[model samples]
Target: MRTVLDFTPLYRSSVGFDRMLDLLDNASRVASVDNWPPYDIAKIGDADYRITMAVAGFAQDELTVTQEGNNLLVGGAKTGDDSGEYLHRGIAGRTFQRRFELADHVKVVDANLTNGLLTIDLKREIPEEMKPRQIEIGQASSPAQVSQIDQGQKAA
Candidate 1:
């Protein structure tokens, strides 16, 4: 299936959308969709995020979280029970997959499963060069250094 993305017209007016176009191109190449175990992604802090998935029948031991380059891969498989009888099995009980793309320097801090909620925490580490710095101002020693006095002298 081909998606008609007429970004050329949009790209002309939106200079900020250049990166978005690259992301959309990457998304077009991903030809798989495995929407097992509905999940949610939330921004917890300025540079932190969390991904929560509703894995009701899955235990912590059954799930796995892995990081491959710039993407986070989450998957799980339930061990079959030989003794348990399934008279009416409606829920899905197979391996599930979920992928999330991370920005540069973003990493998974930890993953925890609590009360059927699997939460994956991610934090983006800002580079020391990228952090904001305070620039100190010096007191003017000469009257000419003051911009108001300079303008007054020019008027005179």
Candidate 2:
């Protein structure tokens, strides 16, 4: 049994949170998808993330990593021939495409393939204007206070 959450109420009362709602919906949808060429997502640093996928038989040329808008796409396609006679083939040579929805300021930093694993590094870079900043508070002087100071200065 699958339970669907209704976000109509949230949509009606919120603004600038559409992406968050969409991410929730996408997460629910991704739960039912097949886990092919298993992958792992880990956080290496405060704002750094890494995604490692097991691609035993895929070469660097056979894999592609691309980013479109707020989505990251990683795909692998076997280009070589499979005519070799194997008594028992255990390694999977199938093509796969995975999609990852990135948050607002997250970006792909680097990608490397080593030891039959494809690792993709990601980092979140918040702009200076978007980051939280402290504002200096200044003392406010009313007209009466200003007049009092002026009168005292004249007497002195």
Candidate 3:
């Protein structure tokens, strides 16, 4: 069973959350049956992430990884054909393209293809100005205290 959710009411009440709401809306509309070339995303440490995809029978040249803005695209295409005929073919070699939506400040650090597996590394690098910082507290003389000091000086 499939259910559709409406988010119009929340849209009118919130600010600075348009992207998050759009993501949620889009995810619900997308079909789950399009999943192919299985992949995994894991948060290995603070501000660090890893994505592993099973891309068997695909060469490094045939696969591509790209990141634009906050979106990541991974695609693979099989080129040429094997000469030998196979009576029983079980492996899949179809072309596939996968898209990943990344958060702000997240970047793709590296990607590697080995042993029919593709691994991508990502890190969220917050800007120095955006990071949380400590503010030093300083003492300030109140108006009443300053007046008291002035009166004491006058009496002296």
lDDT of 1 by residue, 21-90 (tens): 8888778877777677889999999989999999988878899999998889999898867487889987
Instruction: lDDT for model 1, please.
Output: 0.86
TM-score, cand. 2 vs. native: 0.83
TM-score of 3: 0.82
Which stretch of 10 consecutive residues in model 1 shows the poorest summed lDDT? 139-148
The Cα error of candidate 1 at residue 44, in Å, is 1.7
Better of 1 and 2 by TM-score: 2
- What TM-score fits each model? 0.69, 0.83, 0.82
Model number with the top TM-score: 2
lDDT for every model?
0.86, 0.93, 0.93
Q: Which stretches of candidate 3 lie over 4 Å from their true place?
A: 136-156
Question: By TM-score, is 1 or 3 better?
Answer: 3
Compose the digit string of candidate 3's lDDT tens values, residues 1-156: 768888889889998898899999888887776668988999999999999999989999999999999999999999968788899987888999999999999999999998998999999999999989999999998999999999999999
Off by over 4 Å in 1: 6-20, 29-32, 132-156
For model 3, what is the C-alpha lDDT against the true structure?
0.93
